[model samples]
Target chain A: MSLMDKMLALDQRIIFALMFIALAFPILSPVILPMNIQQYSRDSFEFADSIPSGSVVLIEGGLGAATYPQGGPGLEVQIVHLLSKDIKLVFFSIGTETAAWTVTAIDNALAKLPSGVAAENGVNWVHMGYVPGGESGVAAFANDIRSVKTEDHFGTPIGQIPLMSDINKASDFAALFWWGGSEGSIPFGIRQIVTPFGVPMTGMCTTNEVPNYTPYINSGQMIGIIGGVRGSAEYEYLMGMPGLALGQAMATNFGGLLWALLVVLGNVLYFVARREGGAK
Target chain B: MQIPMILTAVIGLLMIIEFFFPMPASVTSLNVTLRSFVTIISATALILGTIVLTIFHTKKVGTRGSEWYYSIVYVVAFVVTAGLGVLNVRDTTFLWIYNNMTSPIGAALYSLTAFYITSAAYRVLRARNWNAAVLLVCALVVLLMLIPIGAILFPPVVPLGEWIRSFPSGAGFRGMIIGTSLGIMGLGVRVFMGRQKEHLGIREERRDSE
Candidate 1:
């Protein structure tokens, strides 16, 4: 076979192997790719930074294991940043399956934070567990927060949590930060939680879903956004603290470049082989 | 008459009712219990899915398919992971396999989409139609905007990219959101009201026989 034909006929496993190598290389070596650093990331950090030390910030954990590597790192950084500012966090998951994951994410994040700056569970932060219903739950929370969640994730009553006691309604929160994969819940949060009460909201979402949330940001429904791992890296950079997000973003960019090259080469081979076959 | 379908319809009706009026304390408690039940059911579904995957591979291996080696790799990975998880081995061989082998492999697998996208874009841009040409141009613009070289070549491309992302494209996406929400609401209502009765998958078979 001609070179082009050989390339065109390459086994799928070979391609998978190449991809494996390309993705693993940057992650193992740890190279930080230079990014444009979108305003969304910067804005999210600024929103977190601008909140008063004792102000209540709601961190909505709406993701599951499927999105851990991509969305989780950004959340970890945001949680750390929020804690650094001495912000009081009210953690909750709207989707039922996400509650346990949310609590685990909080615990993982708190464990990573510096000893003194880390949020103290039940005091500095409280998880309100999973609330059933989507928009209805948000509306209920807006009207009477106590009605939606009586118990925290660990079965501690919200009444007992000092940080949650004063947050009787949506208006009490300085800002609401939602971290989730692509789901209707974020928009539900925007409409029922933020729009009606005029509470500012921000979102951290998968890269694929960032564009969907952009209009909410532009329309002033969402104050800011952090898109995927790259956005997380930008947040880490803005905070002057680098973590797993930075590594993941670098790996992603490197992977993107490698993939682009392979595509070009594959196409060139495809066209050349087609032409040769046609001639034969 | 399947237990699962009957339960689903009954539970769905209750959820819909809960939305319309202030439910009694017992009704609300039932709803919460139902939510937990759904969660457990979904978890079981995951196991069922894994079982299906194993059966598919077993068939392939038993039949001596062309990619039997790959099937073997997958089964080994699955068995090892499941074994570790079940045995509660924190730093077991399977955990290492997952952290070292699976995680990176999965990441790499997804990352390969970047290359496919580039090739797809090239082919798409080469199309002769005006709409296709416009799409191709928009894609190229977006692609260039994503990369650093585009900004270095044309500084305004970054803002231009942001504008494209935030304005025209954003409008389309918002339209999609509105459309999807309406669709989901319609589907939910239909399912709750028992208007759409394909839940059992037996209706088609009955129709075919008739």
Candidate 2:
């Protein structure tokens, strides 16, 4: 076999090894790569910034373990940004497996807060945990949030929570921030809250779901989107705080480059092999 | 059959009215109650699914087939996890299992996709035709634009990628959403009319020859 044939038929195990190196090297030795801030990421950051201090925002943590690597860091960074601005937040989920993730993100974000800033549950923030019934539950929650969530995630009565007293419905929220790993929660925000109540919304989605939510951004339905790993890196940059998302920036760049190179090399080798075969 | 159909129609109609119309407090209260009922039903369905899963795996373990060891593992894991969860006996043990074992295993499974995608892209993404060639170029451009190194090296590719995503990809996605929404609307209408009762597990009883 010629060089082109060998290249085309390169062992997959070799490719896997290369991919492993590409992902692991940067992760082990972190690189602070320059991230070009996309409009969507900037928009998302600005929206979070624009929220008036003391106003409440509903954060939907609609992601699970499967999408944790893609969406978790961004969620934590967004939480940090929200808490830093002193905007009270209510974290809830339509994704059933999101409660543990919400707790971890809240803990991580609170731990990283600037000096003298502290987060007190039922005062500054409240977690309503995972609400069942998917879209219908979302609709009901939007209509009368307090009614749907009579108790906080910790089983504290909503009436007892100071923050809960201020938020009666979806309209009371300054903005709706949905950190979704899958495409499940975006439409609910649009249909249930934004369209009906005219609330400003922002979506933080895994990189793959960016396109699905982009049209909504274009249509002004979503104020902005924190798209994928790159978007998360940009968000951390804008906040002047580096976290897991920013740390993974180099790995993302390296892995992406490796894949792009393989695509080019694979095509090149295919053509070369084809030409050689035709000539014979 | 008739009772269920009538009940579904009433509830569906009420929801629709509650959504579009400015109904009174009485009707709105009923709407909220109905929504809560749906949530409760969904929660119960989850429990039912877990029970079904446990039974299925238990039966597999009892059969002692070639893959029965995996079934035993599943059954053990489920029983232990469920017991720990119900008891809330050892919070640290539960969290440790979740954070260390479950989360890492789930993340590892998700990460494996990267290797598979790279391998698949190399072997499968061919430019045999003009359309395929365009797709290949578009994909490469988008990939390059998504990465930080690509943006730093060739800045123009960033806008090009955004444009591609915004127009071509966005338009395609919009079309799909429209198509899907229409189909869902049709299905909703059928369900409301009791034509799609089977979807709700209300299948017609058929007498069997056996």
Candidate 3:
């Protein structure tokens, strides 16, 4: 076979090996990536920064274990930042079994924070648990938070939770942060909670959904956004708390470069083989 | 049929009714009960999905397929992560799997898309016709706008990119949203009225006499 033909017909195993090596090498190295911090990440951090101490903030952890790598890190950083500012947080999950995952992420993030920076659980923050019905649930919460969330995830009544006592509706919270998956409770929250109540809101979404959500950001419907893990890293960096997010972004960037190299090599081999065979 | 769908229809009707008039305590209690049932059903579905995935991979490995090793890796990872998860062993093994295996694999998988995109762009941007040329130009413009080099080429392209996103692309997205909304509404009405029999896996037969 011609060189180009042989190159074009390269074994799938070789390609896979190359990819593995490329990704593995970079991941093992501690190389900082030059990432463009979109306005959304900055705006999201600024929005969190602007909130006064002890202000009420509602965080809807609208993702599950499957999407942890993307939205999970962002949620972690946001929680830490909020905790550092002494913000009273009301946590709830809107997507697939997120209550458990949200709790885990919160605990992990709090543990990673500098000694004594983490908020004391149940005192500074309370988890209201997973609310079903998507948009309908958000509408219900908007109308009357107490009516929808009768008790905390652990069966503690809302009236008893110190942070929840001040929050009766969307208007009560100083701000809202929603991390949304493709099909989650955030759309409903945007329509019902933020729009009608005029409560400032921010979102952390997967990178694929960033383009679609930018309009909401520009329209003032959403105050800011943290798009994917990169956004999470930026937020972590801005907070002066380098954690999993920074590591993940660096790994992702290295992986991207390696992937680019493989593609270039593969194409060059294919073209060279083809030229030698006089088929091009 | 599934219990969840039945509960959904019944509760949905009641919810709509509650909107029009005051619902009694019994009706409100029933609605909450139904909501809890749906949540339980969804959790069960998640478990079922995981089981199905495990079985599929296990079968592949048992059959000694070309990628049997990969299937073995998949099962091992799945079992280790899930087993630790179920046992509530969150600190050591579970967290290690999450931080090392899951995180890196997830990042690698997603980052690979960038390579595929470049290859796809190369093949798709070939000059074939006016439409193709227009498509190529627009794609390049958008691609350039996405990268930092585009801003260096022309600083105004940033705002222009923002304008294109908010105006033209946004209009297209809105059109899609409206179309999808209409389609969903139509389907929902049909299903609600019990006219969409396909969901039941039953085909209607025309009467010869008619």
**Highest DockQ against the true fold, candidate:** 2
TM-score, one value per model? 0.70, 0.94, 0.69
The residue-level lDDT of candidate 3 at B21 comes to 84
User: Per-residue lDDT for A1-280 in model 3, tens only?
Assistant: 7665565556655655655665577567766645556677888899899999978888887765556766787788788888888888888876535675688778877876667764766678888887765666666666566656678776677777776656777888889888775444456667778877888898887756766776577678887778777788888888877777777766654444444444445545645545566433
* Complex DockQ per candidate: 0.18, 0.68, 0.15
Candidate models: Cα lDDT each: 0.72, 0.82, 0.69
- Off by more than 4 A, model 3: A1-37, A62-74, A95-118, A128-172, A181-185, A195-199, A233-280, B1-10, B17-30, B50-115, B125-157, B197-210
Cand. 1 TM to true fold:
0.70
- Stretch of 10 with least lDDT, candidate 2 chain A: A271-280
Task: Please give the distance, in angstroms, between residue B142's alpha carbon in candidate 1 and its true position after superposition.
Answer: 2.3
Clashing pairs in 3: A4-A273
What TM-score would you give candidate 2 relative to the actual structure? 0.94
Per-residue lDDT of A1-280 in model 2, one digit per residue for the tens?
7666677678999999999888889988887767778888888888888888888899998767777766677778788777877889998988656777888878878887788765899888999887888898898888777656788777788889988876778999888998877646789889999998988999888887888877788888998898877777788788887677777766777888889888888777777767867311
Q: Which candidate ranks first by lDDT, i.e. highest?
A: 2
> What i-RMS does every model get?
5.6, 1.8, 5.7
True-structure RMSD, every candidate: 6.0, 2.4, 6.4
- Per TM-score, the best of the predicted structures is 2
lDDT of 1 by residue, B148-177 (tens): 445555577678878888888889888987
